[model samples]
Target chain A: MHSSTFNFERPIPAQPWRGVAVLVIVIILFAAAAWEVRCRAVGYGPTLNDTEDLWAQARRRVEPGSVVIVGDSRAWFDSDLDELERGLGSRPVQLAQPGSCAYPVLEDLANDENFHGTIICSIVPRMFFAPGGPLVENARKAVKRYHTQTLAQRASHRLAVPLEEHVAFLKERDLTTEALLKELPIPNRPGALVPPRPPPYFQSVDRERRARMTESCANPGRLQTRVKTGWSRLFTPPPPPRYIPKEAFEQRIAQAIEARFRDTTAAVEKLRRRGGKVVFVRFPVSGELKAFEDQSTPRTGIWDRLIRDSAAPGIYFEDFPELASFTCPEWSHLSAGDSVEFTRRLVPHLRTALGM
Target chain B: MLGFFKYGNFLLENFQWVLARGGITYKPPHLDVFLPIGISFYTFHSLSYTLDIYRGVMGPTRSLRDFALAVSFFPQLVAGPIVRAGDFLPQLEAPPKPQNDRFLWGLVLMTLGLFEKVVLADTMLAGSADSVFGYAGPLIALDSWLGVIAFAGQIFFDFAGYSTCAIGAALCLGFHLKDNFRFPYAAIGFSDFWRRRHISLSTFLRDYLYIPLGGNRSGAARAMINLIIVMFIGGLWHGAAWTFVVWGLLHGSYLVIERLLKAFVRPTTWTESLGVKLLIGLATYAAVCLAWVFFRASDFTVATRLLRGMFGGHAQADAILSTREILQIGIVTLGMFIVQWSLRETSLEAAVARLPRSVVTAAWAFMAGALILTQGNSNAFIYFQF
Candidate 1:
């Protein structure tokens, strides 16, 4: 038989507890205040981090016949919600995520039997046709969060909005401990396969998941240069992994891309069968990033194949002089001013594509 | 029902494998089951109560409300210190008088826990561990070792953080929960490791399974078998995967080997020296890390690949971890070792008591500040799955 009766009280360290508490609070407050001021001085502002919760919030707003935007950051950045609302007769639900594949969101909508509305999917070919990696993972994560978010998580996100809206240093993507640590100037081994750090925050996101390029990023400056420089590295495809044979890896990638094309065509067809409309749009890219992306994932490749396979109406930025004229300040996304104009000009083409 | 959720697919897959070996092909219908969060912990909480009552250690509580409260004490309900019903029921017997000191101390502990989780585990180690583990290419030995080491630190902080937070939260509610971890990385032997690490699970297994199976009383061989059986069950308790089972079996094997060594080797002044203990502790940590490869890996393929890389099988492989990641792992692991070594013989409360009030305040402030910087981006507690 077990011996002892259960009686255990945790020992609370005897100290001047009140003094310690007060002092700790004071120090934390001072440190936080100093950090906030420093962040603001360095061009950081009170902007909500585009979290999975925020993505889920936007996803939940999608009604049966709602005009939904599903794609990568181009769709997120360039499309003005206000302009789209005015043009499309309904405000499109912004489901597009930065650095994420559009396929998952497209697939999710296809699977949603109730959703028979129009989908304006932005085509960043590399991201759109990504087989598996962070690009696909990010979109899948947002979609998963929409499905699996708990009441506690929903509540936490709701509470965080006010604080995130007011606090400049609450930038989860950049100013977090992990992000700051990544900013440290440490050299890697020559052959190290480390991924490049993501570009720092250059845009502000609103409650509706609308992202607008900040003035610091939009104008020709340090932030703009830094953001532009980071893109070519990110856009260029990673080298084939050493573990797999080169031919085998290439063949696997080819197969995956083919599968994606077939799957996308089927998804678009499914939506169309249910009285839904789908249009693929290739958003404008600029500078070195555009060159790298064009070289890697050319229009003759995934984009043309997708439009042909899906038989969805396609809008290529380069095909139209008006849309192609506006330059992306940072080479990847549109500035706040240009985006509104871009969205305004693009609305008529969208109307024609969807036959609205 | 809980077991079905956790083990349904695992069992089916294994069964299919077994059938294939017998030259029969079978395709079982897949069961899509959602694993209830903290299913393992709460099951133990309820199981311990029934067993305790069955064993005449404690009487069955008449009040269903009190029993329900003990079973689902929110703080420890999901990821636990696995608070026993016998311990908790008695605490609930008397209403606790809330004290300012205890509540503030609890808040301090909670801050420390969050700091460990957010800043240390998620920020410093998880990326490196994840990058190395998730890489599709062969990795150099340095990357392999760093990856495992990163995982070791990450799991410790992640789990220990949750336990500390649970204990602190319970304390805030005027209840006491026992410590789950006690500088486990400083343990000098497998026996010592179990004694310090996951104390609740270890004790629960010892009391319910090991002793009942003729623990050390019968004979050396029988005791060894019992230890392995208990650890096998312990490993299975963690997850449905064979990797977890392997992890458990590795620990069980380590325990048996230690027992055999103990039978031959005698303790002396030289053996008990600080340097020797430290060396042994490092070896114990290394072996534990090897086992953790199995625990953390997705499958045997990943485990074997990592193990081979660690042993320099991939001589010409590319280095996957960046210099920053390597430094982060090195600094965090070293800091952890120092803290664990210093506090091996004491409790956190006792250690804090010895510090100057100013020093305590500064440490608290530093942890809180770092936590604020983290902005709560850390993943959920590792043990919540278990």
Candidate 2:
């Protein structure tokens, strides 16, 4: 019936809508079941994606004098929080992110005047000295989330955790339609400037942001090869933009790198002045990837300069045979088993470095 | 308040530039303003009420609570269909009656909207568009055109998706918000495009701004001037940027030209033919896409560069998009065009009504499944900026 008054009522289509709804629900349930099965068969397991919200959740747990792990993926994957808690007599908050620069997190902690805490910073020269772009942006994004996370985001993360713990198909980074789309084997035109794709899901993350190398990825197989190759693509510096002159671009990069050095020193000094301790640890790197890193961003250039400039104690893995004896399966990160052993061997050094 | 938040810094920067040009140094303290989400939308929502009351179209409501609800309805609060206070207030007078059909349909619409936004806009198109637009150097023609096409599709889905969600959510609560989009890509003329896209804003401008300025009551020349003036304001309504102003002005010019052409070239059999209509429809879309360059670009420099590339000005430039990205853009754009054109002549409800029950169930299921596959990774709605 039409209303003559201003109150308009839209026409409902004459169909069995309730029946349709039931059918839709049934179909969705079936589809979800199939998808979960397929996802499991393809080797995806129920694990947390290291999202900004998850990082923020972990960041909120930081107390005034807590031990915190901060840096790139090496810190994220290699630092066993349980072992560190046992050795250092306090658990460390894992604030490190994969493919992220440590500078932003370090700067954030230094600025948090109340936090005169211990920082065990991982130093991969290529990642640590990154002045800007995705490496720095990633850390900055997590810090920003920590500062600006809304109630809804926090609630959503809480709800998502339970679902993520049981669902193999809920891999946000790899199983999402966008990520899957990128996996398509389509060639680019000659001279096309496409960015390299990130490595696939090869690590499992916990609620506390601790990452471990998946058994499949840790083994010498296709997954290992894929992860290894992906690293080389990721670590190699992209060519300068065509719009900018090569000399100018190089000069700008050099200036940015120099700024990073000064900033890192200032941050370290600031933290130390506030009675906080910092230990820069160079985790293991091996094989061709180690050779590549050694050639591209040698320890002598950035690492030695950082230790000298900041006057902070550093633990170089290569300096100790106990640490250097462990080989990274993918030439970058330790296997899940080795990471435990690695952490066990390294905790005494961490204790010594922090004067514990 | 909306003006101060959205345009304060823009005004200050422009004033500084003007002062510099006049050989006088003037420095204004930058106002660090955070724009309240949906300020523009709510401003318009409240403004419509005041104007409606002022013009005696409707008497002011006695209930302050109802008026407040009308102004700040949660479904359309942040990004909107720009629901007019008059349309919304009457529905709140009575308590809503729950209907299972209405609720289910609303869920269907919400699912479809999310699919458009997350799966299509974010996953398929955003990356290529971002790569193309964010590229510092010039791009080849294919990449340039594909980028623009991707953006055209992305914006349509992003905005229309929000509007659809808003409308569907409102329906779920027994409120009837009018449609914001109606197959705008299939529009045959600039005026038609305006009619079909962001229908509320267009109607608002027509009633409040255009008619207030005497609309077409004056001579043709005066009417043309009025059109430009209305469009200039419309452009400025989008943002404080001159690029947005130019985008508005380009549409203004297109409307003026369409008017001029209609006056001189009487419709003949050839012009009225289906083929000619299709051709004109395509031309209208292309022109609209061209205008979108200014709308989407950060500045005139980007708009000009893209335009140059679009017209074969960058033959020796780099090709940035991959084959997969190219195919994604092409396929999505084509599919959008087909769906829009097909549905141009009828309402979505009518089209859905004609479909069999099984088909409807499957389509709904597919959209829902696809949405789940997206893992809720979507950017904020595009219109939330405006």
Candidate 3:
């Protein structure tokens, strides 16, 4: 509608360096400095995220006599693979996928000819009580999506792992210019921001390192108050008591147990037939999370049924005093410090259960 | 493109269900999303190029590389403003023009577009719309309206956001693409709405489809029939679904009724009044939104249920969304409309150019902040699936 914004009289830079040379460099420097400050303030060092690549790296290092660990995030993150390996005099291969259903991985390991070593799977009640098929569909979806991506996509992801490990700025995908624009409090609309989606990491990271990064990231801004933490706060004034109908509760619980039993047992039998031992480990969960798991899937109700029907040796953490004594900072996954200790404490019990 | 393959399969699936096995009844073994993401759009882009060349409106290109570049221009290659060859091809030969003003303007635009996409469309609107649309059971009145209204905003932002990004990216490279959208929500009539929304596609359909079908020059009856026919095919062009056809029919009916009403209902003086314009604009938007129900729903049953809820069929159903979620839709949708209406007669860059330096910087800062606050794994633009 008006004059051209471009000033054609001015000579342009040559190809491949036409624009934003200085600007891009300046922005990068400024951002790097900002992130350096934030990381230093939060006391987090250069640490790679716990990702699929790291998991693969760990898996590749598994020796023939090594015990293969498989389950979900709880099993993988709550124990130090190195510590467990040292404690048991055997290495550990972590095939434990976060958000994965345990049975499928179990089934895969059972069918493997090369892996005749012991298996340890931690069963969180939610996955065990869920009526769906093994939630290992993520592995399939990831594979499909992976195939569709270009070499550039792969390279970019590979580049991001190191960048994320080093720079807090790269770690914050939501802190982009585009994302920050929408955070302005202009209204006639909702001011609420959608929670950021985690970047898909193809490589494995140090579990301890990632947990620490998460801790750093969750730090509040100046205006934001710190979240209250206490044993009493876990119960609160307590959440409003919810009522589930007896018929619905029992029906769901029955269906869930049946599915878990049918799937887990099949996996265990196949593993046993291959001269490999299968053992279930209940990971340390405490506070409100433990309460909910206990109620939704009582040890007697679901865990006992699976162990009984599968004929696999089980270790309920509650049954052993030391295993249950470890503090779970998040009440789901153990902190980096405690995970090593927890692994050390459980090694003898795990050895006994595997009849090693 | 695999889009045609998917469309053919979709038609066959729906055909058997609606027509009671009138032909071969085939369903794939498993649910697979095999359809190419932006096949429909690229097809139209190429289609427009070919038509222009065939009609002697644009010269045939001798350079295959330039032609390919035009067709596969990455900015709008997938979901597009459907840039025409006459506008974009010549610019390809020109060397890159680097000016701080143009570059900064492009960055500003890109930021705005991304904000519209991930924040407003995906985060705020999509969740609410999905809750109602994907529900197996019935939705109540408030829920249905909220769902559809949110959709009206979502579809607008999603596609417009894409076009804005394309335009901005091209702008940064010193290639100008005509703006694809205007203040579509503020349009005072069906025809006005068409003029504003997806300007390239609408014009192409008008020139290639409507005019060839004898347009308004043919008598009233033939013209009306032509309009309906063009729109019906236009709907089918989006996808092979019957729902799309119904959406077209709804729009066609609105246009016809508006045509009939134009002669008698309006006092010429009243038409100039801002209040009257606002009233008409709102009514037109509501009409467009109702048509969107058919466009968005999976099938006739869902559409029927949605319509029933809209007209007060179900008032007592349990709420599917929280207040915060609804608040999100309202705020984002309102913010979009306010911005659009405010800058109705000017471009975003132009409007910002007129602003004081401090205000412009602050606005850019706010945009950046907003984008960070509302991140999501946004699905591809809604139009890309077409």
DockQ of 2: 0.53
lDDT of 1: 0.91
Show the lowest summed lDDT stretch of 10 residues, model 2 chain A. A1-10
Better of 1 and 3 by DockQ: 1
Docking class of 2: medium
Comparison by DockQ, 2 against 3, better one? 2
Collision pairs in model 1 = none
Superposed Cα deviation of residue B204, candidate 3 (Å): 1.7
> What is the per-residue lDDT of model 3 for residues A251-301, given as tens digits with 9 covering 90 to 100?
765776677678778878877877888889999887776886677568887
lDDT of 3 by residue, B326-351 (tens): 77778877887788778777665566
Instruction: Indicate the residue-level lDDT of B348 in model 1.
Output: 94
lDDT of 1 by residue, B105-200 (tens): 999889888888888998899988988788666778889999999999999999899989888898899999999999999999999999999999
Lowest lDDT 10-residue stretch of candidate 1 chain B: B372-381
After superposing candidate 1 on the true structure, give the runs of residues whose Cα lies further than 4 Å from its correct spot: A1-4
How much lDDT does each candidate structure score?
A: 0.91, 0.89, 0.68
Q: Which runs of model 3 end up more than 4 angstroms from their true locations?
A: A1-73, A87-119, A132-153, A167-257, A267-277, A287-292, A329-333, A352-356, B1-3, B18-37, B93-100, B135-137, B300-302, B372-378
lDDT of 2 at A201: 88
B281 Cα displacement, candidate 1 (Å): 1.0
